[model samples]
Target: MQQVYPQEPRPFVKWAGGKRQLLHELERNYPKKFDTYFEPFLGGGAVMFNLLAKHPDMKCHVSDLNSDLILTYVAIRDKVTEVIESLENHSKKYQKNTNFYYYHVRESEPTSQIEKVSKLIFLNKTCFNGLYRVNSKGKFNVPLGRYTNPNIVNKENLLTASRILQSSNLEFFCRDFETVLHDIKKGDFVYFDPPYQPVSNTANFTSYTSRNFTDDDLERLVNLAEKLDSIGCKVLLSNSKSKKVENSFSSSKWKIKEIQVNRAINSDSKKRTGHSEILVKNY
Candidate 1:
C-alpha cells in the first residue's frame, strides 16, 4: 500500500507542544541506521509520520498513554473513510452556542470502538483552537473554535496516512511509557517526547490528559534512557530547558543540546513565543 507520490504531509490533530518544527532536527540527530523505531509519547505523531515519509522500509512501533490519541491513530489506520465522514458530520452540526457545543460534546457516548474513535476525532476537530483540554471528571472541556471553514476532516491526507501506516510493519498500543522498554532491543532507536518539566511553577502544562507526568516520572524516564544506553540502543529525549530538568539529568552519559521551540499555549501573545528546550541524547 505504498503510494508512488504521497500527498503533502499534515498533522491529524492539534497537539500542545507538538513537534512539527523539531522534525528536521530529530531526523538529523537520529542514527542513520537502526533496526527498529519506537516512540512512546506519540503526541500528534509528527515524528512517526516524518519517519514514514523518509524511511518507508523501517519497522515502527508507537504507543501513547492517552487512549483517545491511540484510537485516532487506529481509526486512521483501520477506518479512515468512516472517521472522515463522521468528522464532517460533526463539523456541520456545530452550533454558535458555546454551552450547546460543550454539553453536546460532554454528553455524547460511543457504543463501539469505531464510534469512540470517531467521537475523539470529532471533538478534536471542533474544539477551541483544536486544544485537547479535559476537566477533573475526565470530560472534554475545550470550547468551540471560531473558524469559518476549519478543515475538520482531510480525507486525502488521512487516506495517504492510512497507506503509509499499511506499508510499514508497525504496531500501535495504548500504554504507559515504561512498557516501551519491553519491546526495544539492541541497535534500535527510541525517541522520547515525554511531557516536559515546566519551566516555572506557574508554567506547568503537563496535564495533556487526565494524568500528569510528574517530576518523579521525569526521573524515571531518565533512568530508562540510562538503561537503554547501557544496552547499546540509541536514545534521544526532549524536555523543557529548566534548571530542575538539567539538574535531574546532569550526569556523565547524557549529552544535552538546547533548541528553540514555539510556546503557543499561553493567552498572552508575547508569552506565546519560542523558547529553548533541551534535547538529551546518549550518543
Candidate 2:
C-alpha cells in the first residue's frame, strides 16, 4: 500500500511558544465570518498554516519582528530547493561531527539569504530544545541538543509549506505589531500570538530576538488589541495565564478561555506539564 501524508502544511521551525498543540481550540474559537486574516507575531506559523489549509482563498498577511525568521520564510517560499540542498549538506556534516559542526555554523554568520535561512533552520533543528534564542548582541546562541538523530532537512514539510506560501494570497512583513493597525480593515480577522507574558520570574524566555518582550511591550500589545477591537475587527489572542494577562482582557467585551498546553521547550520536563494559556476572543 502507498503511504499517506497529511494534506496540511506544518510549521517549518520549532518556535518558543508555537501553537501546534492548541490548533483544535483555536479553530473552535475562530470567528464565524471575517475578511482578511492577519497574524503579526508569526513564530512557527502553525496557526496560519492551519487557517490557510482550511480556507485557502483567504487573503492572509503574516509577519514577525525577527528579520532572520522572516527571511527564512521568504527563502523557503521562493528557494525551497536551495534550502533543502543546504540542509542536506548540514545534515551530512553534522552526522560526521555533531559538536564541532553545530558550533561552527552557530558561530559563523552567513550573509546570503539562502545561507542565512539554511543556517537558522539547521541550528534550530540541532539546538537545545529547538529554541530560537539570541544574545544581547543579536546572535544565535543556543547550545546543541543531545538528540541521537535530528531531522534537519524535513523536505516534505518544507515543500508543502512552500506550496502553501506561493499558491495562497499571502503577504510578508518584518515590522512591529502595532503597524498592523494601519493596514487592517474593520471586518478582517487578526490573531495576536505575541511572546507570552512570563508566568514566573524564571519562566521568562522571550529571547527570540535581542530585545526582550517586556511588560511595556505587553501593555502595547493589549493597547493594539483594544484598538483593533474598536475598529470592529475580529481578534483572537493567545497568552500565558498570568495576573497581568487576565487583568488586561477582563472586560466584558472579551471572552477568555483557558486551555492547557504542553511546553515542549522547557528545560525541565516536569515543568512542561499542567501549563494553562488563555485565548481572548472578540467576535
TM-score for each candidate, following the candidate numbering? 0.92, 0.97
Among these predictions, the greatest lDDT belongs to 2
Model 2 TM-score is 0.97
Over all chains combined, what TM-score does candidate 1 have? 0.92
Q: Candidate 1, after superposition: displacement of residue 2 in Å?
A: 8.4
lDDT of 1 by residue, 172-214 (tens): 9999888878889999999999887887768877777787888
Runs of candidate 2 with Cα error greater than 4 angstroms are 1-6
Number of clashing pairs per prediction, in order = 0, 0
